[model samples]
Target: MGDGHSQVAQKDKYVAIIDQDKVTDEVRNIALRYDPLNRAGRREGFHVTENGELHIDDEAVIEEHKIVANRIPNDAIKIVRLPAERGELVHQYGENGFRLYELPAPVKGTVGLLGRNGIGKSTALRILGGTLKPNLGAVSDEPDWDTVIREFRGTAVQNYLEKLRDGGVSTAYKPQQVDRIPDRYDGTVRELLIVRDERNLRDKAIERLNLEHIADAFVDDISGGELQRVAIAATLVADVDAYLLDEPSSYLDVGQRLSVARTLEEFVEDKMVLVVDHDLVTLDVVSDDFHAFFGDPAGFGVVSRPLSARRGINQFLEGNLRDENVRIRDTPIDFLRPSARQEMDGIPILEFPALTKKFQSFSLGVESGTIFGKEILGIFGRNGLGKTTFAKLLAGALEPDEGRVDADINISYKPQYLDSSFDGTVVELFAGQVDVYTRAFETEIQQPFDLEPLFDLVVGELSGGELQRVSIALALARDADIYLLDEPSAYLDVEQRMSFAATLRQFVNRNGAPCLIIDHDLLLLDYVSDRAMVFEGESGVSGVGRSPQSVRKGINRFLKIVDVTFRKDPNTGRPRANKPGSQKDREQKASGNYYAV
Candidate 1:
């Protein structure tokens, strides 16, 4: 009896330890099941020893691993482990190559594929969708589209389809480029739904995405955020068993992003969804399982424990934030004046006069020269405000129905969708048209901005944050007297955003070049801008001018009013403050938090 009780206690202790480890034994089994070698060795349980030493054992517990691996035909498994060097060429770019290995069987429910940019996230999605083939990997049990349709044609087909259609595994894919929608679709929102056989699912998607008003507008004419939602709507209407979405929240506002998160919850209840995105914030809200891939010569590959399920997903998010490759920091441009009034009496670089654009129920004045050389002008507004529209008009891409735009000096505008403007390699842009600026800002652009290796890489293929950095580099390389940027730090992580703010300040100081930027990144706005214009009131959109000091006050007041929670550093219990430029000064002021406003 004593020996039996001891054995029971030991067993209970093992279970207790596994439970304390956070990930369950079931999850470990699932991960190991994908690799048959693990199962064959009887190494399938949560722990190798009683203490849980050699491995944490959580990798095997992924819920979808069992379902996906089970679905994969035996032929696919045979091909997955083929020699990497001998595989058929799947995709080839300058230094990037991709070869498909055996397709992992589709998982039972939604699955998320995560990784940094340049890791073939999109390429993998394409392979799964049958739009692209793997160069070196073998594909077995490839589902035939014609067979699916023909096999399910009649009553006889329905009976035969039971095994295939157990739960209806449909697929909807949203590409990375939001601007890639066909230029000639003459269908209304309702019409597009019908075309996609998603008319019934349209209302739910629309309500979740907040797209009731622009249902009838042309796809090309809507705002970037609206367009993204519409694309989601089109995908949702398909009611696929799984979804392949690439940066689905790229242009959405904060509120809209949260809404999309909720919608994803409803959409993926019993389906498999793979998403490729750089927005860690949005991904955190939606992901069930995480698979991270890193770029390599052969192809992008997965990281088993991308993040610890025990420590939770926040650690993974921080890892992404700290990755230097995806972060961008613009050189600080230092202007002579400390205030907006201290401008040199020269030709106004750019001007907006009585510029009013009205869509449905909103209007704003796109005012002029309030912007001067080397000055950082910050434009502030609410989510639905015309800040983005104002940026488009200033860039000369959108024609304002009510006002005229005049440029006294050369101007370069960085649109909100910075990726769309990039058509060539980074090196081509530097040496081709903007060579002189690159030579002038050689030290800053090369070292601080870090555009060296990216010179050979295609700009269109870069991640969102990476593209933003490239856009800043391209703009700084230009000789234009005035620079216009819209949400320059939208996609950047905390560190990159700080560096970008400093860089903008440095640039303003060196050349006294004028810059106007519209953004919701308040910390950046406060750090760089000498003057700010707050867009308030009804249709008139009054510009309440404020000094940097006063602007800080306004921001603090607004934050208090809104009750937004600021993130605190895990290492240091205090609220995380922006890094100070001078280490000595930062040390001196380390005792207290720097409160703006």
Candidate 2:
């Protein structure tokens, strides 16, 4: 969009551009002649014959681009690129930006935007939703529609933009913060949803999302998960050309996340759909192709060209962008297997008998479990299944109705939701906390979380991810035999979640302190725990936590109940959710093995 005239000169070196409409027959023939299934090394040269036939010596490059192009459905509307400038801030509100990347919108399958937070993903989606007109690098002046149309001429996006500029297209956007919906609306969920039902899809959406019971409930009374479903339902009911959802997986359990993905893939097949999610497994399951965002968060954001889902995600985990010739991270994030459980020769750090906690309409029964000095226990359960209730009982924040935690042992607890009530900077809040300032903690917590730059920021003004990191550090820095962290990975991006998991494992192993972590992220749990506890029962009415078992056993038990299965990715060995009713899912279910091998 910057000055039009094919400003892709900088990226031309690594990228091979071919106009699909203008390509010669010979060029097309050569591309089709190559065996798509061949696995041979490709050469590296670009050549053009005198007859205007284009050729690339590198078969791998041709194959890669071919796969991407092939994946784009024949009915794709347009390819969009949002570029960012680096080296200096564009204005008082902008930072150095990343380079140009492309987002192709297919009329059918979803195209995911994956990256760390604050990488202009939301901005791009806003442009697509028509909520924000892209300045297209001309922030100082008004957007020029004529130049923008000319730049993307001969593509589906050009015609789309022309219609958009002329007020012909409509879009429905589900924003990232579903938790904030209550603040903007005051009505029953049904009322809020039905009012937006231009397409008469309210009933269908509600049934698909399992929101029948809460249809008449006030928006203010619903939980975060409920709010998310309601928000998605509203988006679905609206008649729009594009359906954009930002972080639909947040506040949802693994099962619910899958449900949402299925609903979108089923009902929104004919329309353009775009989604942004940090849960790697969810993103992989929901998207056909992905556009990866890379660059310094809050500094500069760059979008990568589209690639097949598996390849793009693998590249992201590898921290390398081969086509862009950039390494976004210092090192690749590995999904390494957890170490074997340590033989606990020492005495148990804490042991609790069967515990019961009852609230107004909810009750939790925790089966007896023991934690050794060298063990970290992971808690897996759906929302309202009393995982947090068990954690609170362990931390003495709540007294169990009928059982007791060891009164003599010390425990530190980080709650599920964070509170930013501190009236000073982050450093000031931890001024006398010696461990936080020590070299060991700095290396383990500060460096990995990138907290050094956030130390001077006001505690009340910190972002969700920042506050989570601070809360984790505070809990770890305290002198305690056991730690209880509830939803510590909430709001953290994939990179931060991976880093935090590593840090937590190191702290638990190094200090020989036991930890009980309750979270919904399966990947983080797999990476950090030696054993897991599965909670089962009615979500709100009653929940029963089973005794701690091996990680695989617990995961298998839980996933079996939820009717889902995981398979290991051949490239990264990461856990990936199998499509429901797929061959792998059927095979695993038949064999009574839900966890990946």
Best by TM-score: 2
Q: lDDT of all the models against the reference?
A: 0.52, 0.74
**Model 2, span 1-597: residue lDDT tens:** 234444433431222334433355544554444424233333443344565545442222432454533433321111112222221111112111232333344345788888887666777786677776655555447448886566566655567778778988788899776766777899999999879899888989999998987899899888777888899999988888889898888778899899999899877877888888888877888888787887656544666767888889989999987776667787997855665665656569988999999888888899998898867788988776888788878888889999889899889998865768789988777666645757876776667666665777898788666788888887887788998898787778888887787777778888889888888888788778878999999876899999998888998999998899999899888788988889999999999999875
- Runs in model 1 deviating more than 4 A are 1-114, 130-168, 182-186, 197-199, 295-301, 306-313, 317-361, 365-383, 392-410, 417-433, 436-438, 441-470, 487-506, 519-597
Candidate 2 lDDT (Cα, 0 to 1) = 0.74
TM-score of each: 0.58, 0.79
Model 2, position 223, has a per-residue lDDT of 71
Q: State each candidate's clash count.
A: 46, 3
| Ten-residue region with minimum lDDT total, candidate 2 | 87-96
